[model samples]
Target: MNTPQKAIALGIGAALIQALMLIAFAWPAANTAPRDLPLAVTGPQAAMVTQKLNQAVPGGFEITRPADEAAARTAIADREVYGAIVTGDGAPRVLVASGASPAVAQQLSAMAQQLSGARPAAVEDVIAADADDPRGAAFGAMVLPLVMAGIAGGVLLSLLVPSVSGRLIGLVGFGVVGGLLSMAIIQGWMSIIPGPYPILAAVAGLVSFAVAGTIVGLATVIGQPGIGLGALTMLLIGNPFSAATTAPEMLPQPWGAIGQFLPPGAAASLLRSVAFFDGAAATQPLMILLAWAALALILLGVGFLTSRGRTPASATTVSAEPVPA
Candidate 1:
């Protein structure tokens, strides 16, 4: 009931929430399962390879038969598939797209090794992660920072800018500049993300806008509680559910599906698509981000309209009310 008690309760509640979130996220990662992970197969004996793979790890791969090794490579580069198995005169080799997901590449490579038996097979990384940080650490590393940026952008603009137009402009400008700067640091300095600088930067900008807009719009509609709600959704729920370090399918049911629908997850997907897949798998994620941004704008407009309507009504009611002695 007292100040100290309230502060203690708040601290305890926050700690518990953080602990639960940690466990929820770590459990899935600690117990990863290969569930319909995408893979491509091509060569003279593609069908036979598929059958063998199916037998080895049932429900592990959602196999696609690319026309040939070339097509398979193209698919890998495009992130259509995590890896591909090519059969030939020599030992069958597994081609992996480590850039998209290093853990997936490792899983496929291990599977390939097991299948080879007495004769060993080669495991090639068709699209490797950054040489400096081959495990794609930088990609995973960016997730939390980006989320924080979005939240900060939204909360700050909502509090500082009085007018709707000013807030909108401020958030947009922040996203663009912040995104480009972050991209330059990650891609240019760290070399974590490869080339195509402008495109990657644009993806970053889009993600920032989605995050900032949503938060700002919520604040406009709901006041201070909106800031806390935004943080909970984007940071607490969104980040852990994103499965950035691991494949979404690898996570438990419902969570994986839920993560895909959130802004953080969508942003992560778009970042991967642009950085390694040449933007081949960008449509869905891009649309998701755009939709969030649109929703934010709509909410802001509605809030403004509602507030204006209420102002006149309150003024009239005050004049109508009798003064007390």
Candidate 2:
């Protein structure tokens, strides 16, 4: 294509790309509402409360009738449910874990107020968020930066480190350094995440490695286009659909569940679990991250072998060629 035509095409493509990004970021936020958010109810009026809640929000909550208030609290603490409602003797009490999801907590509080009508229900934060990040703004803000760091690490390693072995070393180094640095900033400086330092740091590092390693491995096997694909997947789909700023159940149906399978989403969920719920409900997200890491290693090995097979034949052919007079 001529310069003018190419320029016009590029401009149009950029516009379209920008539009797509805006939609990816905005759609979820605009549409966020509890689809099947888990909530536990226990007491003599548990059945009545559940019925009222179902009528009030229709299908907003998935209400589980625990044996009693103690069981409901345990469910919330264990991360099995976002909140619980205790409706028995005196007044109704709502137990919420803001650290698990501030959005969900706020939603539950609002719902409780609505249910109580004239009298406000007692709302207790069973697991409160970090004091500095009561609303979870800082915690939510961390996802994009982590994702960008991982993408940059992988892209740089792929471009600068030619050998697969060198790239592997670089990926590991980046994960370690990046994780520590991120923890220092978010945990130490900003006080965004509250958890055991070592475990939190390890989680951060693993997440970084999972993202960077995936990118590097894909590039190694599929060439330049792989880097683009990796970045697009993490940034466009993973970051937006991660549900870091909101509960996963708040997001659109399949996408919410699908996001948990990706690096950004899994990392966010895992971080929250460790930071707030004392590792409750961490197994699934941990497994997802590990699976990605494993895939990266396997791809790197395959790539190394494939390149090794080509190198010897090319070298042999070059050595056998006769010199020109």
Who wins the lDDT comparison? 2
Q: The CA-based lDDT of model 2 is what?
A: 0.91
| Residue ranges of candidate 1 with Cα displaced over 4 Å | 1-8, 44-48, 312-325
Best prediction by TM-score: 2
RMSD of 2: 2.0
* Model 1 per-residue lDDT tens digits across residues 1-325: 9999999999999999889778766777777877787889888888888999889879878999988999998888777788899988877899998878888888888888877676888999878888987887778889889988889889888888867788888877987898789999988898887869888888788888888888889888888788778877887678887878777777776777688788888888888888777787888888998999898899789777877667565556646577898
- Candidate 2 clash pair list: none
lDDT of 1: 0.84
Task: List the RMSD of every prediction in angstroms.
Answer: 3.3, 2.0
TM-scores, each model vs. reference: 0.88, 0.95
- TM-score, prediction 2: 0.95
lDDT of 2 by residue, 1-325 (tens): 9999999999998999899899889999999999989999989888889999899888999989999888988898899999999997766789999999999999999988888778889999989999999999988899999999999999999889999999999988988888888899889998888899888888889989989999999999999988988988999999999999998899998989999999999999999999998899999999999999999999899999999778565556655678889
Worst lDDT window (10 residues) for model 2? 311-320
